[model samples]
Target: MTSTAPAQEWPADVRTLAIDVGGSGFKAAILDPAGAMLTERVRVETPYPCPPERLMSSVVDLTQDLGHRDRVSVGFPGLVRNGKVRNIPSLSRTAYDGDTDPALEDAWRGFDLAGALTEAFGVPTKVANDADVQGCAVVSGEGFEFVMTLGTGVGTALFLDGRLLPHIEGGHAPFRKGDTFEEQLGNVARKQIGNERWARRVVEAITAYDRFLFFDTIHVGGGNAKHLDPADLPHKARIVANTAGIIGGVRLWDLDA
Candidate 1:
């Protein structure tokens, strides 16, 4: 089920189609090997009960007209390992913010997402945890760099001296008050608490992570990151734009190589 588009000129020899699959939306753009976007990003509202095939179709529709793509890169919001979906917090639910469905959860587990996408798009494909892909674009490759994406739920990635570390669903780890970080700092919390206090909580989360990880630098980026107060951010931390998810797609191949 390939989506076709009129061929457009690409500035670089390799044309990478970057897809950022968020819980709320799916965004896509074409990028040069250098990681600069060649097409304006296209986005679509995410569908509920999105099994693996439905998500892939949506992605194909979202990127069909962006331009010709030589390769596909997906930034999926989940724990992906070796092209398989180990766990996906959002799409496995019966509905957005709804209870999880055991059937849906079973469908998503062990799904060969990258292979399915490669077959659908008829191009080579790679899938990584959304935060890991975002981190690829922002990390300086210095010592102990960490990334936390604040959105539908928290997502995290870590690096050591420029080498990508194994992916961990750190957002699901227990934080304060016996609640996971996602329960406290996710979008719902941000909306309910309002940005001012939410921003403070964000700072607090980073502070707690700093104490635990002792990271040399921490980068925060996501759809909701724009609402944060810059002054509240720690000196060792900085905010990056959500576009990092798309731009980092090109860099992901480099990490693999």
Candidate 2:
């Protein structure tokens, strides 16, 4: 049965187990209700052939040292609908043939991630796209806001007047040369084309997205965000800590958030 700790008798400061599942690493930590980390975050390299079962096992192992938590939240690098993963490009063999194990792709598609985590940890669990979760941690909640995460792949999330909009897998949308945003700006692309060229691509992407969305503000995050120079970013954009992934997890349980 699903635990309803957050909606029931859980204390105001109840701890939350926050997991950030990325293409390159799986990280976890304990956070207080206010979204502050209560323990040192731990990370492990994402296992190759990272199907649901293997990913769950790694998450459990990584958080073994963190103390008790009332609930769990996960920020996944994929399309999540009602806690199930619909598409995980970085893990899909069809999308990254050389890096992924083809045999495991189907297992990741349509995986019930929240159900599995609730069963394993015996706590209420919520799952959402990594960028959506990060947006929760930093959005001003005043007007139209956008978030872009630059990591193993690009991720985007939109909010208007503080409410999340229906998710759009814009990262997979074509950006240049008939290639998806991930193909042009993802980590592999940066390595293949060099930082200067990658930075240029990022600038071009920002310009294009501005014209398309016209958001009041855009928060840029993820591991690769650090590689960008502040001066190179647009006036409407600002860099946020990668830790927003972990911190934002708590907001998943906020009914009004």
The numbered model that scores best in lDDT is: 1
Off by over 4 Å in 1: 1-12
Query: What are the RMSD figures for all models against the true structure?
Result: 4.3, 2.5
- lDDT per residue, candidate 1, 43-104, as tens digits? 99999989988998898888888878898888999998777889998898867788778898
Which runs in model 2 stand beyond 4 Å of their true positions?
1-6, 94-102
> For residues 140-172, could you state the per-residue lDDT of candidate 2 as single tens digits?
889999999999999999999888887898888
**What does the lDDT come to for candidate 1?**
0.87
lDDT of the candidates, in the order given: 0.87, 0.85
Model 2 pairs in collision: none
Q: RMSD of model 2, in Å?
A: 2.5
* Residue 73 local lDDT, model 1: 80
